[model samples]
Target: MNAGLNDLQAMHLRRLLEGGLPLDARPYRRLAEQVGASEAQVLEQIQRWQDEGLFRRVGLVLKHRALGFRANAMLVLDIPDAQVDEVGRRLGQAAGVNLCYQRPRRLPQWPYNLFCMVHGREREQVCQLIAALLAANGLDEVPHQLLFSTRAFKQCGGRYAPPPAKEVANG
Candidate 1:
């Protein structure tokens, strides 16, 4: 909401973003056309918003199943608190690791503090890849589990802007 952007333009841009960027070679140009502004202006406004902390990032949500990646697994590890950060960084950079993150260990039942995702065309392939990742990271003896996804779930990016207000009927 900078001075450079009017309320109407901001609303229009947010509504368009809610559905995701247009699938075109020049998506920015398309967005500029919709907002009646130059592509550079639109990009500059987006950068300003980002700098003001309106949104931290914009990223892709891949449809792995559609790409023929049938096997997906969450590899959870029970790394010691002291070494969790180091281990997580190493695994995050390794191949075959789609995503990596750390979470609090829910003791007495769940003890995993680190998690990474691996995907492949088959369960066996995923398992082998996970094994290689662990071995390469020198975590051969770490306590872990490979929880393969049993079903595909909908995936999408974050939506921040609210829907447009409904127009009232005239008396």
Candidate 2:
């Protein structure tokens, strides 16, 4: 729905891109064929979309359980407000942590603020990594809790759509 892109072309582009590029030497060429566009045009359009801020970084989403990473835990730390940023940076940079972030504490109950996720084939391995990370980051004494994954869930990319076209009577 970006300006200047036709409805049909936009739908085709979305349909093709959502499923991901085909595994081929010339994926752009294949995409172009599927979308009825030149390979260079396809690439150029994508770059244009990115430049226009309509796109974030293109990345892969992996299924940890399928990859044998059966153990996963989300660690929440009660970091002081003054030190949260520095601690978060250290946690984010640590090797074992897949994701690190800071969030506000829910007062009167939940005191934890910072969070990070660690995944491994074994819970012990994850625990070891977390221990090393904590000792290295000087957060060994920080109040923290670990929430483990208890069930499997389906995974898929989000779907997006433009507003529906307005209906008009043809006289």
Instruction: Give me the displacement of residue 98 in model 2, in angstroms.
Output: 1.3
Can you give the TM-score per candidate against the true fold?
0.83, 0.76
In terms of lDDT, the best-performing candidate is 1
- Candidate 2 lDDT, 65-164, residue by residue in tens: 8999989999999998999999899889888888899888998699999999999999999888888888888889999988888887766555575544
Q: Rate residue 93 of model 1 by lDDT.
A: 92
lDDT of 2: 0.82
Candidate 1 lDDT at 44 equals: 82
Q: Scored by CA lDDT, what does every candidate get? A: 0.88, 0.82
TM-score, cand. 1: 0.83
